[model samples]
Each structure stands twice: as C-alpha cells, then as structure tokens.
Target: MRRGCPVVAEPLDTQSLDAAGPAPPISEADRSPARAPFDDLASDWRLRHLLDVDTLSRDEILRILSTANAMAEVLERPVARTPALRGVTVFNLFYEASTRTRSSFELAGKILGADVINVSGSGSSVEKGESLVETLNTLAAVGADAVVMRHPASGAPWLAARTIGGHIINAGDGQHAHPTQALLDAYILLREFGDLGGRRIVIVGDILHSRVARSNIWSLTKLGAEVTVVAPRPLLPVSMTAGAAEKEHPLSLPNVRVESDLDEAIVGADAVMALRIQGERLSGKLLPSSAEYARRYQLTAERVAQAAPHAIVMHPGPMNEGVEIAVDVAHSPESRIEAQVSAGLAVRMAVLFLLIRGGA
Candidate 1:
C-alpha cells in the first residue's frame, strides 16, 4: 500500500516508497496566479547554484517559495508533467545513500521534462577509485545542465560548483546544509501560517549532526522566525549557540536560541520540527542509550499539546518512530510531515525550472 509519506525506518534504507505521493486534485483557487508579492514566473533569477540557505536573501527565498506555489498547482493537474525543463540534462550525483531526497529529485526532474540521470557513488566510478573532483568534472564534461549532489562531506556541493560547469544543487552535504529541505519546510509553514515573522519554531533532536537543523536555522532565522533549538548537551553543537561569535558560526542568527529543555522550548511554538538522529555520522558515543534519549527528547502527543493549539509537527524523514518522534505524533492531525514531502517535490521542481528554464 502507498503510504502518505515516503519516510522509512532509517535514512540509509534505499527501499522506501517514492517521495512523490499522490497529487491532490486541482481546485479553482489553485489555477489562479500566485498570491505572493513577487512574481514567481519572472525571468530574473540570478543564482547559478543553490549551495546553501545562507546564499539566499529574504526576497530570493520568498521568490522560490512563491514559485513553488505555482509548481504545486501544476502537480494538482490531471497531467502533472510540465515542459518547463524540456531538453535540460539533470544529474543526481549522490555520494551518500538517500531515499526521499533522491526519489523526489528524480520525480521532480521527470515531472518537469528534464532528462534525469542518477549516479550513486558505489554504482559509479567513485567505487573504482575515481576522485570526487574527477567525478564532478566528468559529469560537467558529459553536458549535465544541473547536478543535484548529496555527499558525506560538508562542503562537497561548493567544491562541485567550483569544479563543474553546470549548476550545483546541494541535496545534503554532511553536517553543513540541506537547503531544499529547509525551503520545503518553510513552504509548509508558510502555507499554514502566512507570516513567519515573530513565529516561534522549536527544533528538537540531534542538533550537532543534523544538516536539517543547520539549514532550518539559516532559512527560518532569515525569515524572522524565532527558532529554539532543543537538544541534549552532547547533541547540541557549540557553533549553533548564541554565545558563539559571528565569525565562528555565521549562520546562527540572533533569532535563534539554544535550549536544553524540549518542553520549555516547545511552549507557544507555532511549529515543532524533530530532526532525525544521524547515527551514521555519530562517532565515539555522542548519545546515551536510545531509550534514555527517547525519554528526554521524543516528540510525544503530550509534548505536542504543550505547543500552541495550532502548532504543527514536522520531521525531515526517514523517522525513527518512538525515538525522535512517537508513532502517533508522526501521524497526528497536526503533523505536516507528509505535506512536507509533497512540498519537497514542488519546491524542487521550482528550483530546477528557475535554474534551467528561468521560470515560466
């Protein structure tokens, strides 16, 4: 049976459902022009590559979100395919294993009529001793118009953008940034709460190793959201704290505050995002027993009630049910987790359309 979200039991599991869930039927309102202030169909998109959320300004971020709204309308249509990216050759170069991200990117590209090619590290020349630099250069040499890459290293996309001729979209780069995930997350919130300014957003979980948390910090703070990052002392990175210097943690803006108490931080939150525990990235025991961690951090139904009455629960999946988030909470009416995946498709389609065809 097709589930609502493609979230699997683990992030490394390659057998998850396709991230593009069934599209909602189009409505009369969906056919209308986007209501965002900026014109999403404009031909003035300037960024060549989406390497990080830090590179995007408030206006640019809004533009992308607005464009995604238009893309959503397309998704609801009888025939969801669009010719916006026709003749474009897009390459998904994933060094790390992924299910949601990889599947969504591929679906997004195909839906936009791009010639999508997927290349995994193990399946590609990287397994046969090809260097990252060589692999990136090779994709460029083969006429890739845009390359979506997920790597184990933090600044791999930046390196690829420098080395390759095509555009570099950071799928997820180690503990650095997952820009698109942040965008889709923001999209979900924007749809729920029109204005993010002065909104309280609580992020709970393994903050130290989560690229999702890092990316969310940049995007949410930029949009004037009051972001509270809650985690255990070990799981919380010193770089993301307010006490850290600007030069030390440039992306950790003034709107963000660190908290050790999930319940305390979640109070009056407009949204609560529980990040996945990045087990593969952990080394030398950053966490205690999983049971202990769950007791301290799991987003349960009771804790969800502590937030604002309309507060939405979010997760950048493959979720560890009963670990980072409780099973019922993941499927709760207030949970926007499934919608986040759907929004990812539209957001990615917008990204590719704007980058390749320069919008509608």
Candidate 2:
C-alpha cells in the first residue's frame, strides 16, 4: 500500500548516540547501495499527487528537475525506453481535448514501461451519465496506479484524489493549475540559464484565463526569477491587481508585476513566454478587438529584441500564430518552444517514475 507520509529521515547524531564510546559499526542493511545518477531522487519523495505547482517546495521541485536530467539521458538512448515502471498502469483521464499534454503524458508512461490507458470525456462513460468521481472510482477498481486528468472545471484533480486511492496528476483544470507544464517550463529555463536567481521572465497574453500564467508565476518566482505578466486590464485577474495601491496582492505574490505595456515589460527579460488566448474560458468580450490586443500585447520580433541579448522565447503551445505571437518570433533562433516539448516529455517521465516506482 502507498504511504501518505514522506520517507525523509532526520540526520543521525552519532556524537550523542554513543557519546561514551564510538558509535556501533554501520549495518549492511542500513547502507544504501551505489545507484545511478538521480536514482535516489525520490528516495524521500512525499507527494502522492501532483495537482499544482504552488504546493511544491523548492526542494521537491529541484528533485523532479534533477531526476528529469537523468530521464533526458534515457531519452537520448537508441531505444529511448526504461523499465522503471515496468508493471505500473497510468490512465490519462482527460475531460478536455489536448494534444501536447495528453500525448506527452502517454509517451512518458509508455517510455517508462507502464501500461498506459487513454480516456476522453466524449468517448467515455461520461457520455452515459457517469460522474467524475464515478469514473475515477471505476479506474481505481480496475487497478489504476495513477490518473493524469484534465478537466474544464477547476479543482477536479483534487476531487479525484479525494475520491480515489490512485495517484492523481493534474494536466489542467479551468484556469487553475497545470503543474507539469510549469515544471517543463522551469526545466527549460533552468537548462538554459543554469540558475533563475535574479533572472527576468516576462509572460504575455491572457493572464486571467491562462492556467499556464498562474502556475508559471508560482514556479518561476519560487525559483527566484523576477516575473512580469502583461495582459489587457480585463484579461488580468482581479487577484493580481486588487492591491494595486500597495503594489502587492495577497494571492498574486510580491515577485510578480502586472504590466499593461508589452514593450515596457519585455525590457531586460531573460525569457518571454506568450500564452494562447483562452476564448473558450472568457465569459464575455474581454478585449476591444483581436487586432487591438495584437497591436498592444502581441509578442513581436522588435519587442523581443528589446529583451536581454541571450533571452529565450517560449510558449506553452497551441499558439495563436499572428494573434498572440508573431510567426517569425515563434520560429526564431532564440525560441525554446520546440525544446519545451522535449523537456516536457523528460519531466513527465520523471514525475511518473518517482510517483509510482521511487522508494517502492
């Protein structure tokens, strides 16, 4: 049975344990065997579910990234497969349509030797009036080791975790959190810059509706990166600008700056991420016009030139070409959009391996 408690142990005090004499000789059973790089990353891993980036500590985040570094090596091999999760089963329970995330998770699990199942809201029993909890319970009844879910409603993964015993990985939940996306984004950034401390990252486009923006704010800020989020006033979440008078919002965090001007925000940035406009999630007309938004906030080649010389360009995907980002900039030499996909695969592989097989 999976234990909810983390495996971390307190450091032993040999000086106090046997102060009168030398400590007892080390026991063979207590000695950890020599292991491959990052094999022990999850030796003390505690999380049973990865629902959001906000809950992950700096150490936990580092562990996942460090492990992903090892997984990247596995991906580089001729076969690009591993027996890490040889007998494990991972179910992708996506309630919303997905291309990058669903495919990435499926590939990650399969690459790790896990039995992966793909389920969609339209094709599943949900069409037959099955509930979210009911669907998760059904998966658990059939020996599902983990459920990576994406739903339109917020907090669906948390609900699934509470309803089932299997590990829960949130793919995305209605402008809530996409932990893996943030992880891969962070991984890509770390790979490029080595350290995020004092680095400037500007996120452009819809902030209120973009779950990627919310999660990125948490992940990047925790890593010591200064983040500036640019969006139209209506597209910006109230939580971010509520305390504008004080220049700090309780939910939005102090490290995050809300900017109305795209040109101003891009200056001196180490990386710039453009978010897809989430029209489906918008309740009403949030922008005056697409052209107006593009004129004001769209990431352009000239604007990118204003950032640091070595700055990288990024997007979470399903990019709106000429709408949110210019075509040339998306394919520019400084763009890490394609690299983010590769990093995502490695990061997901690490997450699946650590959750299901680590410390087993």
Candidate 3:
C-alpha cells in the first residue's frame, strides 16, 4: 500500500521508454539522488520559465514526471518536508479565484523550505488600478525568485515572463493554459498506465474555454497519447478541427481528433476526462440549457461502461456536481479525480524544484 491507500497495481517490469529506445540515457550525475529526493533527468536542460506546455520538450516533461515520482515518495513518508529550495522565495499572484492550485503551490513551496507569499487581486494594489506589470515589478523588487500566477487575461503569464526578471509559472491564464494541472494529470495517468504511448484519452465537455483542455492537449500529445476532444458544436473551438487549417487560427495538433459525439468519443477509450462547463467565462448563449448539456455530455455510468473496463475518470474540479459527471461516477473507484488533487502537491513541488534549481 502507498500512503495507507491500497496499491493500485504492481510496478511494470519493462524498462522505461528512454531506456529501451535510442534516446541517450540520463546520466547518474544528473539524477542527484543524494542531494534531492528525486532523479533529475538532464543536467544541461534547464527550465527558466513555465508559461505553457506548448513549448515544453519531451525530455523536460519527463524530467518533471520523474521528479514528481520522487516527490510522491516524500508525500507518503511520515513527515513530508524537504530543504531542496531552502533559500528561494516564491510569490503567488492570482487575479482569478482558485482553491486547489493556490493552496497546493503554497504548500509545495513550504514543504520545500521556501518563503512563499500569496497576493490576491482582492486586497492587493491590483484593486487600486495598479497595472499587472507594475505589481509584478514590485514583487520582483521584493526578492521574489519565482512568480506563480493566475490571471483572467490570456497570455498574462507570457507577458509577465517577458517583463519580469524572476521565473514565471502559469497557474492558469484565461483560456490559454494551466500547465501544472496538466502535469499532475499526466502524472496520475502515468502512475496508473506506466506509459502514455498509444493510449486513447477522451476529453469531453467545454473545450472552447478550458485552459485545462488546451494544456492537456499539448502535454498528452508530447507524451504520445492520442487525444479526442468531445463537445457540442458551440462549446468546441472552431480551431480545434482539421477543417480549421485553412483559417488563421490553428488549435489542432498531431495525434488529436475532434468529435461532437460524447458516446462515440468514449467508446473503447483508455481514459475519459469530463470538463466542467465554465459559465462565468461564457460570453453568450453557448448551450441550450444545463439539463440539455448534462443529457448530452455528462459522464454517466453507462457512458463509462462504453470505455475500457480499466479506464479512469478525471475532472479538473470545482465540479458542477450533476452537470459534467454523475455524482456517483465522480466518487467511484475508477475515478482518479481525488488522486489528482493529492498528486498536485508532488507535481507542483517538482515544478518549483526544477525551475528554481535546474533553471538556474
């Protein structure tokens, strides 16, 4: 058993992909087992800013995963504490509301022995009409080593990265990306399946406005997983399909497919991720009604039965209970939603550690 929870399955006997393939082996010196809790994948490959997964190399994603594995071990211990980032300081600058992302980042920094300061838009100078760049510059002036930010505007983190000297990590930015959430999600799936190659993952629901969906597409594809995004015509982005190639916007990626039918997309899939309908972000009428949306796209038990028997269920939460997923299915054993929350701590820890140390 791991951390008093039943061990999901036995460890895979086969070698990891990098070890089996022609890819260069990660050196022992890069592992840093003595100095840190996890195995660092590469020595020269440093990550300075984490604005989006769209630019992350396969090796960089693997490094974060491997380090997260070690951090998971620390989480399972009696007392989870590490001095990996003892002298570093992190600032959490959130212009939007959050619970899991905010708390986990703060906890991760604390566990790693970093001084973490949280400044939300409500009480901060942002309320006094201070510009984002001005607030970020002020934070940087106070010796912040890194800034984990969530803003209501797309490309906010990218703007901050270009403007600030400190490393910028995107917690979530408008409809652009939430890279670490995608990392933890991939981590959960990696633990369950050992490898993501050839796996079919069905992402169902509001794809048009979900930053989680955007980030997941980039990371999951990079890791060799086939993704099928399912949503109603209005809820799905126009750039998400092959037909959009002729248009200016291009959201489609290799190994990804867009489907309008939820049941068709879930059929024989390895995993099903149901996204919450973000009503707040919706500009105009996108769906007929909440009941209609639930009837068409919700992950009912019957819909889950259509997937592979071992297929997992996921949601990047603040779930709208009976809307995107059946309440029972959300609490079912096949659901990895809860585990994803626990994995967030480790994943965020690995991210902070890598960006602070390796990025240096």
Give the worst 10-residue stretch by lDDT in candidate 2: 2-11
Off by over 4 Å in 1: 1-40, 240-252, 280-284
Which residue pairs come into collision in candidate 3? none
Q: Which one wins by TM-score: 1 or 3?
A: 3
Off by over 4 Å in 2: 1-39, 246-252, 279-284
Record all residue pairs in model 2 with backbone atoms less than 3 Å apart, i.e. clashing: none
What digit string (tens of lDDT, one per residue) describes model 2 on residues 7-33? 111112211111223212324432334
| C-alpha lDDT score of every prediction, in listed order | 0.79, 0.80, 0.81
- Which pairs clash in the backbone of model 1? none
TM-score of each: 0.85, 0.87, 0.88
Give me the displacement of residue 340 in model 2, in angstroms: 0.5
Model 1 residue 360 lDDT?
17
lDDT of 1 by residue, 147-181 (tens): 99999999988889888778889999998899999
- Choose 2 or 3, whichever is better by lDDT: 3
lDDT minimum window of 10 residues, candidate 3: 3-12
RMSD of each: 8.2, 8.3, 4.8
Candidate 2: C-alpha lDDT: 0.80
How many pairs of residues in model 3 come into backbone collision? 0
